[model samples]
Target chain A: MKIGIFFCLKVWNMNAKIAIQGIKGSFHHQVAQEYYYQNVEVDECLSFEELIDSLMSGKSDQAVMAIENSIAGPIIPNYALIDKNNLHIIGEHYLDIHQNFMALKGQKIEDILEVHSHPMALLQCMEFLKKYPNIKLVEDKDTAETARRIHQNQLKGIAAIASKTASEMYDLVILAPEIQTINNNMTRFVIINKADNFVSKNEINRASIKFELDHKRGSLAAVLNVMSDCKLNLTKIQSLPKIETPWKYSFFVDVTFEKYEDYAKAKALLTIMAEYFKVLGEYKNTKP
Target chain B: MKIGIFFCLKVWNMNAKIAIQGIKGSFHHQVAQEYYYQNVEVDECLSFEELIDSLMSGKSDQAVMAIENSIAGPIIPNYALIDKNNLHIIGEHYLDIHQNFMALKGQKIEDILEVHSHPMALLQCMEFLKKYPNIKLVEDKDTAETARRIHQNQLKGIAAIASKTASEMYDLVILAPEIQTINNNMTRFVIINKADNFVSKNEINRASIKFELDHKRGSLAAVLNVMSDCKLNLTKIQSLPKIETPWKYSFFVDVTFEKYEDYAKAKALLTIMAEYFKVLGEYKNTKP
Candidate 1:
């Protein structure tokens, strides 16, 4: 009977429509495929705002958004978007980002005169690109989209810093592989959905939370102390200025705990301590 | 005698060569000019890395770089750049950013087919641009450079979102004024110089610091408690992952205080409590 119930749950999740921030062969698309065990429908979005819209409007059952990268750090605007839209992060996946230099199959590295990619991709691969001072670097909207455009337009003397998947999908040859400045490039993507989606309590060991504190001395420290006393491990903390109220900030944190009771205890205490508090998500710890 | 000393100081500062990340009319240029009262040589660099090279090689006496914007939050990589270079921040300036839409005199807003600017500028003015759905939004290297290009090429039906100074320098007419989503947009810039240039103790009230805490529970909280006890106001806090060590983080914080002794006390305490500590800058608090 237990096996039958688990099979049913998996079958139900198989039909989820996942919204992503870019077209096929993009990192978002890659995450969607690797994260779900079964085949899922993908609703391609050209931007994060559109991805949120698709989820909110019921066009897609869930969304995958890149929240942070090891090198580039957090994507602040996306945090605001998830908070403002009341979206919940159900899970997260870390992708080993390998930026490859690709162009038309017949072209060599020396033939490239210009390289196009997303600004972050260009920044990550700056050390390698610096060796060729003569090549002009152009910023584009997407990494894979640039590769697709190059192939479709039959462009010459142009290269793209993208993923190996993009090269295969676009029928281009990768001139150089894993050209990022740091070999250990990783991007953390969060799986998000509407607030109503529920996960089993026993499966949750991590949470994303946001809160605001009063202008008291060591107010943040006090809240953090509460988290520590409850045996919660603070993995990440980011403070974003409340735009309307210049100096005031709202803190977003990710924490993991061995017991749900400990998180519950901390939540109760934080609710009383903070002027405003909200749980952005409760999910299984990807790292733990 | 006092007036004569002041006049000599001003004359000495007049010949100082300043390095900025973009050409004249960019926001960096605006800060460079407004921060100094007299004429100074400007060494334009296309990238932040180049800007650092100019400063390190003694090609420029000082450098001006934007640290944070009210709308977009912090520029993380720049923080790493400043910390890694061992540069000193002698002063700071707050520029009220006004993104104006400009084009050739004859073209109307409806006549423009494409708008080009830095990605951050485009994001700041996104609310205004959404109305013109027909116009293509293109990201370029620099806002002022895009305006100059449109002027130099006499490109018809092209608009650029840049500073008011850019319009005047490139002879472009403003199609719309103050087009940023927020009317009170502000960007904080830091004036950096070699470590040997020092500001008097009485003039210093703010500091930018970087430190790393051990893995002990409540280590961060303990450090914050020390800062609070020393009467320091934590204006900003950002955590950057130590790239080499996956889970460990190095914190960058900005603090302000009423007395220099309080800051010194906190620095001493943090030095003892943290595994590693460094002061990125000691300058007057621009906001305070």
Candidate 2:
């Protein structure tokens, strides 16, 4: 009995508590399950703000936050959240999104009066939903939560756009499969923690950074030149306006390189060139 | 009678039909009222897609579209919509956003059980709403529409976060004024027409352009160099992923200049520097 108790304690310690922005069977939940090998205890949050609070308060070991989607572009607020909270991204995962329309087992597509889902999910499946002009599209907080609600309430004449996992989990049937308009739908999620530089230097190949340039002409151009000279390949560049400084902007950039030394050299140069510079994260490149 | 009929026809021809997303009390409607000096007729649309259809089908003379917000960032899909539909932006307007929480007359703030509004409006007023933990926040299609519904239905416990115009138009009483977290909240709107170059050459000081660069290192830097060398001030830059070719991006840029000739010169140089370049619009600078 003593040995068994010790074994159970060790196993519990091995299980990671991962924070996600939705309930079970959500895309965020799916990411948490697929990205980690060990057993994960999910800390479900209704909003991104709540998810950050969970991480900040030490309720969870780490978090999996969706950063951007191929069809929807970046979730800009998440970037600001991560930056403001000083969270470090340790890794990333790209998930193929397949939005499925699900409802009660007895209902056909014609029987549904309303469809509820996350706004982004609803936007993605617009082409499919447009055919059923009579059905009202309502925005909900989460995709899987809606499926769960339909199941728990035994609601009729209502449907949800969610994942296949959600249908299986909530005992719902898929009315339409792969309903997203775009075939190449993908969402990139970042695994973030409170600590920085968690990954070994040699294994790191990508970095996310933010910088501000002066009002001089071609200042941005000059910075990009320095990045090019350092042999960094710019993967993504997004400019967010500084609200306090009306027209001024700060650029959030992602770069990937083959060598750590090259990234380091570029970082050193950028620190000197930019009026404000901060490294949000350095992680292994997930791209093949 | 014949003279009156001819005069009525002439007067009707002079009334410009402006297409806007949302109903009469929406920010778009306010823009329509403020931006044009002519006798204007408003064509209301529920969605941006519907607004585009109205403009494309010639149901309206031109459209007013919100492109970006000070706090919420750019409405990126609008850029893609404009680019894909080949619509030209002929003018711009800036509106100060003031979100107000309103409810049925005689109801105190404590009496409100739910709040309905556009997601953007809800987000902007989060700090104020956070204090009302018992109130449920629901997302709707438009802010003013919710206010209208609350009034029409006599919803005693329901409130809405909308503009002051909405409250006055719907006869609701404001419970909380200026609930947005930021004081300098503003939204930038663009006046789009089907025809290109509606503004004359001498008056044009700003332009919106899109370009794609080769995969070569420093190619973007090289293009920016041309703009800077030609004396153009880069105001905004947003990169949209090319869905067909994953990992590649197309940059949408806005630039303002002192002289139309300087803008013209930079446009020529950017055309030569970029692999693919297109001028999305050329209009007078609205910024002071």
Candidate 3:
């Protein structure tokens, strides 16, 4: 079934272009390279919206978007963007994120007065940075771009917190390796397309879904009970405020099951029970 | 009951100092003034960590932190901070956040080449910015600080997207009023303190809780069913990864009930069923 769906999807497009949200050496670029072929040409985007626009315009066959990070949690607006743009999640990837503090050659940690990186990177490295009281934390647009800028300017007393790949790309010395607070930091990225693309593989034990229930008492619990009755295990759930309606919320849930028929029963029940139910993707369970 | 709690809490401290994450005229400062007293002394911090630190040091009586926004969604790390620092959500305030595009006097949108604001504000104003293809969106550290810099330097072809009060305070002209995508853009700010300040009043119809369920097949579903059985409505739920444990996750839930007894029953059941369960706060439902 997976091969059959892929054969049909391949008939419409001869070339597969990947879209990511930054230039080379970025975490998004790294994930795109790992998920797709290393030789594949990636359409780099400045923002998440631009990345989705590239796919919508047919400039890219698939877009790799970071949906959630182990340390930073969910990137909520991207979920809204996917819903609004009618994008479908076809696959998911988990990438380990490591931030290395790099500086100009021969500059010690004490020599650095200001360190720059993405706000999220700065946040993840807060524990390592707390030791250096004299150093100032600055938020930059991109982690890799900050390293590139520091290299181009050859400025002293400045450092960057970015990937080790970025440190090598910019010819900077790694002042502190793995500066993130957690050692097992990972980000979950989703492969998205313009339409529903699901392949019922025999090993398809996990599914991502979005749905809304009526604003009544026990509405959500009813859905959960349905899933439990169908023998589906709810792995993750997140509630997002519906923009059109002010206070009402829509839920995004990922459920896992050993048997396919159990998931089918739950999906059918949820479709009848939910207002705007959508199966974003059916993929293998990657996370433990 | 709430009055009694307030009386005891007030006797411990004479003056109430409010800690916010930005300078005066920021949206946080505005929320602090409105939630507390207009004459409340504000302790400004550079970052959210500092705000929490101020609370821990007893430098401020309470801290006002933005938890979720209608447009931007939840600030995930703040949830983690509240959990890690053992802070309690004493109250909540919903602030109408209006982002105005401001520039030096006599500058039009067409004249703007670069626009700077906090990343979240820039994201909220993306739709209005789509009209100008020439303008470059820049992310700065703080929204009000960006406006102050633009006004102080008298920069041309540059504008800042910030609160209307920021433009007025910085003496900048408002090029566009309420440029955010949604007119009903409001941010839900939670008032937090270091201790458990819940009063369990008769009018207490809402609660915030943190709990970790057993990683079994139907653990979460069972807890939800208990809440439903007790006549409680789950309004919001978020999952945060346990810091020490790699794959384990803890759930944060906010529920509303018509009768306080029903909530008590649900809370008692959850405490017995869940591992490491804690009631972050019990307060009135302020949202519509």
Best by DockQ: 3
The second chain of candidate 1 has a TM-score of: 0.95
**Candidate 2 C-alpha lDDT tens digits along B114-205:** 99999889878878988997999888989999999999999999999999999999999999999998877888999999998467676778
TM-score of each: 0.95, 0.94, 0.94
Candidates sorted by DockQ, best first = 3, 1, 2
For model 1, the chain A TM-score is 0.94
| Model 3 TM-score on a 0 to 1 scale | 0.94
The CAPRI quality class of candidate 3 comes to medium
What are the per-residue Cα lDDT tens digits for candidate 1 across A1-288? 323433554687767789998778989899988876435589988778779989999999888999988887888889988998999987888998999999998999999999999988999898899899888999998899999999999999999999999999999999999999987778889989897345667777999999998888789888988999999988888788777566678898989999999999999999999999999998878762
Regarding lDDT, does 1 or 3 come out ahead?
A: 1
Report the lDDT tens digits of candidate 3 across residue range A195-279: 6645455868888889999988778878888888888888788898888567788898988899998999898888899998998
Residue-level lDDT tens digits of model 1 in B1-288: 323433554677767789998888999999888776535579988888889989999999889999888877887888888887899887789988999999998999989999999988998898899889898888898899989999999999999999999999999999999999887678889988887345667778899999998878788888998999999988888788887566578888988899999999999889999999999998877772
In model 1, where do residues sit more than 4 Å from their true spots?
A: A1-10, A13-15, A37-39, B1-10
Model 3, native contacts kept: 0.52
Error of 3 at B100 (Å): 0.5
* Candidates 1 and 3 compared by TM-score, better number: 1
How would you encode candidate 3's per-residue C-alpha lDDT over B1-288 as one tens digit per residue?
655665564566558788998878789999987766566688988789989999999999889999988777788899989888888888788988889999999998889999998888998899999888689988787788888898889999999988888998999999899888998888999989877645456758888999999887778888988998998889899787777566578898999899998988888888899987998887877784
RMSD of 3: 2.4
DockQ per model, Cα = 0.62, 0.61, 0.65
Scored against the true structure, residue B262 in model 1 reaches a CA lDDT of 92
